[model samples]
Target: MHSSAVFLIEFGAIILGLGLLGRMAGRLKFSPIPLYLLAGLAFGEGGLLPLGASEEFVAIGAEIGVILLLLMLGLEYTATDLVTNLKTQYPAGLVDGALNALPGAAMALLLGWGPVAAVVLAGVTWISSSGVIAKVLGDLGRLGNRETPVVLSILVLEDLAMAVYLPIVTALLAGAGLAAGSVTLAIALGVAGLVLFVAVRYGRLISRFVSSDDPEKLLLVVLGLTLLVAGIAQQLQVSAAVGAFLVGIALSGEVAEGAHNLLSPLRDLFAAVFFVFFGLHTDPTSIPPVLLPALALAVVTAGTKIATGYWAARRNGISAKGSWRAGGTLVARGEFSIVIAGLAVSAGIEPSLGPLATAYVLILVVIGPLTARYTEPVASWVIARRRPSGPASAPEPQAAAEESGGAHDELADTVRHDR
Candidate 1:
């Protein structure tokens, strides 16, 4: 077979395998991310499949995936949504961001990696996957709840932070030669900020043009704008994913109804390619003794975020139950984690670390959905136990209510009066 034909055949096979696994995963209530990573591992050097695709190409595809994912994520937000949620989102987001980086930094420092590597790793943990969480919640019929808007607000905040952090961290890891100086970096940041501001300010005008009843036109508009912003962000030394997300946020005010109709199908189609390509790139045999430490680090990476998310939500007046539910639901990592890992590779991090990161990612994708599922039960238990007792001057509502309206009358009437 011709080389191009051979590549296409191999790619098709990988996609087929992932689709089957993804279906099985959905039925079994597991996130397909872990399964994809496992698939990557299976085909990697030490595992079963061992297709020798260049990590560089896979990483490129992953970047596109990140950008597309962010674009879709942005589509879910609106200007009004941003304004309303900014208050609580800022603090919670900050805490989650800090929590993500600090733990990974500590772990990397302990492990004796370089400063740049430590920062990259720490920043990786800082992200929370709104896409994954929202999808899961929506599928489970939990998206319309009182807590969802607040959770989404925080997720948006994280996306903004990711915009700043991914680029800076990527530059740092790129080392001295690849580094953009403070002035250049500042200019890039300023330009991005301006673009976003203008986009938000005049979004209404753009919405009129892009917001069509036709799904195809709406998708074309979204894709065109997405690539435009992504291009701008790249020129400014930031990740295109950030550009896509900001554009999404800008459009959030008016994009949902029409844009959703347009893009959902595309997202589903491309999402499969993204995950399968993600699996194709990760080399399983490359992980070494440090694999053990990597898993431990992964646990801390996820745990710190969970704790911080809970703390932030509680601090913001969310009920303990709601806070726990939101925090746990946000714990799963997907598109963002892989994007950051790709950034690390672009910075010349060795293949060994990539495998370790994949191992770490495997755990997050596995645990995140399960954490979301059980959050309700756990939150309910916490809420029940923490209920305030009756005041000294008044009987407890529970006890009093039970006594006054107990099932006693009905049960007493039903029972025979035995002396």
Candidate 2:
């Protein structure tokens, strides 16, 4: 009885604290992800304080958080869309992997963490946070931009790649031999292919069956289906996230939209808890020794991500402006980076990997939004500086006179509009 009360107190305090942190992040106009992780650090093993009874509950919530994150991601697209992305976006995905993923792998090798850790770190850097990127796009009014599709295509392919990547990582972490790993990959790919085939052929049927007039029933059915599929996939040594994602792709039309609407809040809550949970396992004291490497890796990966986005957009015929915008937009990595790192941490691959990942993610997540806002503008400014000042540029006096007149007219128009 005493323990139960203590558990409630700890858990309740955590939720309330998270709410406050999230609210603060909103007002500050940044992702609450870093804040949540920081909060977790504050309450974890070697931080300001530690919880006794509520840790178990938090661990479970973290797992569910991951499932919902993937499910919602899957809900964003149909199997048809996946097929389309695969057909057209393979080159971009390859470039993205080579440019962005290699830095982390190189860094891991440099740190002497061995090949398994290299694979793990490579994944940590390869994928961008779809959640964070989507939110940033919406906030900045880039969702309707021409380059937005280019950005999104890259993300969709990454999502697909993760389906294969996670299972491989799982196999490696489990100490499976090359033979065992091959079998795991084979199972994962086969499962993924089957899910896609089913989704493409019977998606409507699946969604219709899950659809309901009652909101409560709809929520229960969708959530239950996702969990069941996720658990089964985990049992089969396929990634639970991959399973949840396939479920999302399998449900289309009204069912997908309704489930997204209903499950969004749940996704947010659990997702926040998931970030917090990652932080809990990281010792705050371990971060400093890794601070330099994390920063260096963050810088390199940020550049590579921008390059990947820029090249992808350009290859698809996007203009310099839009391509730069896409590049900058992809710089922020959030949820998925942590998700990959969390796996490594749980597998006990390397002690420093968690702290390094924590620091790396925190740095990038904070800088992502800012870079999205400024990268294009900064690029244009540099281009302007490099151009020779010919007769067209030498007309400052005339240009200023014309500009002043235009400003006067614009000010008059603004006054009339305001009136």
> Could you tell me every candidate's TM-score relative to the true structure?
0.81, 0.93
lDDT of 2 by residue, 324-410 (tens): 888998998889999999989999989999999999999999999988888887987897889877655443232333222322232
Write down the lDDT of every candidate, Cα atoms only: 0.65, 0.87
Model 1's TM-score against the true structure: 0.81
Per-residue CA lDDT of model 1 for 100-129, tens digit only, reads 778777766777777776777776667776
TM-score of 2: 0.93
Q: Score candidate 1 by lDDT.
A: 0.65
Off by over 4 Å in 1: 52-60, 176-179, 212-214, 252-256, 375-419
